[model samples]
Target: MYKLLVIEDDVMMSDMLSMYMSGEGYEIKQAENGEQGLKLLEQFVPDVVLLDLMLPDWDGTELCIRMRQHSTVPIMIVSMKSEVSERVQALRAGADDYLCKPFSMHELSARVEALIRRARLMQPNAAGGQQEEAGQASEKEIKLDSERRLLLVRGTFVETTFSEFEIMKLFLTHPGKVFSREDLINAIRGFDSFVTDRAIDVHIVNLRRKVEKNPKEPHYIRTVWGVGYKYVTEVEATR
Candidate 1:
């Protein structure tokens, strides 16, 4: 079962979110204050966090920054404050997605599900038999920095666009996880709605143009015949 932690100071809203999310079949956990929230997080490593900005004890922005110090757990902010400055501040602090207050429970569910799915793509870049656990995805992200478009491909520093980096990171984090065009597009969409499956193919083409030793006859970014693409980690050794 997927786990979600809701950190909201408003008792009614917190209960409502918990009830609705629970109805959606998630294992819901709640905290009334940032302190309690952090305490709960120590014991419960959730797949996603639904955070409210205002709190009686500590601000959510500070908590977001603090969380980034130790975790790459996908955090989606649900807040009453709708100002652009506040939204930007939270995102800069490392919160992945921000949704304004009075959002539909269905929308909340959608965002939560999306974050978890995207986070899962960070495993399997191993080309052959061995594979890492889900938790290792976050550990690799700290060095990969997909948001900043930095990739550590076999210890080589490769720079690309944020979208390209996310694509590469997903492929590298999980070496052999086969993703279709739709799957990859959805994984990278996040708050941006301008992407299309054609766009994903275009990205693959561009990325192949950059990192492949022979972009014309690529080695690392291998097409899965009928499916999509995966980073071939063993390509370096095989070559």
Candidate 2:
């Protein structure tokens, strides 16, 4: 049975979710404020956390970051705010996914299952089994210092956000593999997250500006023109 912790102040919504999720065989725990949520976390470690942004005690972003300080459990933000910037901020703050207000319960359940599955697959990465050697450049010759949240292009440090860093890490790790927008979203955020195309484009643009010598004329991240984007790898001609 998957344990779900819901940190929402809305009494009606919490009651509704508790009844529905309990019927689905998930152990449901509810907290009306961030302080209570943090307290409950000590006693009941949940498989996933359903968080609301408008907590009476603490702002949701701060709570999300605080949760990340101790746990990697997936956090799905259920908020009424649907702006791209708001979504970006929550994701960057360490929430695994975001769902806007007035969402379908079916979609919410699907997202919960997807997040748990992805988190299971990501355990290897979290345990240091899948990370590339820190401070070492791959064959493509780019170094990513995930510990420092830093990206190095040609041995020079460049500024990158959580979103940009994750996307760049995916591209660099896969080398020439093409990643569609949906694929990137699923990898960085969760499956079917509330991220918009504009958000992805913004991250791509920001990455280009930092990594490319000239963002307009890029040599590293290339657009597939109608498909998606891929990291360009230099091929040496065999003499």
Candidate 3:
């Protein structure tokens, strides 16, 4: 069974989530504060984390960053803070998904399942067979190993978040195709996620910092003025 750690200060909300998700077959562990949440994170080592921003001891964004330092486990922020800035902050701090509070249990369940599914897909051994060769075209500067969910830029492996890797996979596979922010949002987080254009922009900026030789004047992923962004084809990258 998949494990889940819920870090929420609200007693009622915590219990409700625990009960509902327990029925969904997740082994549930609850923490009433951020300190306890961090402690449980180490001990429980859950498949997914359901975190709240308003913890008594620590800001959720800070906690998210701390957790990221230690583990790549998926974190879904479940909070009353619905502001785009708040969501951006959480995502920038390393959250894989964000769901505002007062949410439907069904939708929350779906998001949780998606996170776990994506996490599983990222595992090198999740496919349980001989690994396939890394996928690449004639472009010798960038390589994508989908079986291992790894990105190698110029022969060096660059660390990437799940969303960043997914975006790169899409861009590399369909070079020169423009993808709107909305399209990227759906591709990474699915249709049920609470994502904004700013979130996608933040992801793009972070990605550019990692893969681009000069983020200020990106050569691989270029902006399309008002529409969106696209990956440069081999010809464009060479030039």
Candidate 4:
């Protein structure tokens, strides 16, 4: 059975998710706040984390960043904050997926299962099998260290949240590919995620601020105009 850690302050919602996920054959561990959740992580490493944005003692995004520091466990943000900026902020904080409140229990179950499956596939086999790593196509000065989850721009390391790392990994690995808002959301989160298209724009905005020389006219990540966004890899692409 897959293990799930749910850190939600709302008693009713916590109970509901625990019960439903438990019925789906998952071993459920629930924490009322971020502190408790961190403590629980020490006791037992979970396969997936269902975190809330609002907690009495801690901010969810910060908690996520802390979690990503040690573990690559899949984290799904289940929160009431549905605004584009809010969603983008959570993603930038290190969340792997975002599911707005009032989400279907069935969909949540599916996402959790998917994360578990993906994680298993990426795990190195005990029989000495290994997964192939994606290589960068450009000789640009920027680099993303997947193992450390750090972005190095011109030799200066730029810290990034888990979600930001995922987004950048996608674009950097597949330069020149236009990823629509829906495509990006589905790739980072899940197909059933409730994040708005505007959230994608917001994430791109924040990403540009961190990696671009000029956010006004981005070079690394560019808008496709009426379509989506693409990553530019040409050595002369930068302003």
lDDT (tens digit, per residue) of candidate 1 on 5-92: 8999999999999999899888989999998888777779888999999989888999988777777788999998888788768866
**Once superposed on the true structure, which residue ranges of model 1 sit more than 4 Å away at CA?**
81-92, 117-150, 154-162, 173-181, 197-219, 222-230, 234-239
Number of clashing residue pairs in every model?
9, 0, 0, 1
Q: For residues 41-133, write the lDDT of model 2, one tens digit per residue.
A: 778999999999999999999999898877778899999998888887887787878999999988889888888986675565544523444
User: Each model's TM-score, in the order given?
Assistant: 0.67, 0.69, 0.66, 0.63
How accurate locally is residue 222 in candidate 4, as Cα lDDT from 0 to 100? Answer: 89
Question: Which digits, one per residue and each the tens of the lDDT, describe model 3 over residues 1-239?
Answer: 99999999999999999999999999999999989988999999999999999988999999998998888888999999988788878876878788987999999999899888767765643232222223334465776754345688878888776678778877866678899988898777642265689988988999888888899989889999999999985557777
Q: Which lDDT value does model 2 have at 122?
A: 51
C-alpha displacement of 93 in model 3, angstroms? 0.4
Question: Which residue pairs overlap in candidate 1's backbone?
Answer: 122-173, 123-173, 123-174, 124-173, 124-174, 124-175, 125-174, 125-175, 126-175
Deviation of model 4 at 81, angstroms: 1.0
Cα RMSD for predicted model 3: 6.3
The whole-model lDDT of each prediction reads 0.75, 0.79, 0.83, 0.79
Task: Kindly provide the TM-score of model 1 when superposed on the true structure, using C-alpha atoms.
Answer: 0.67
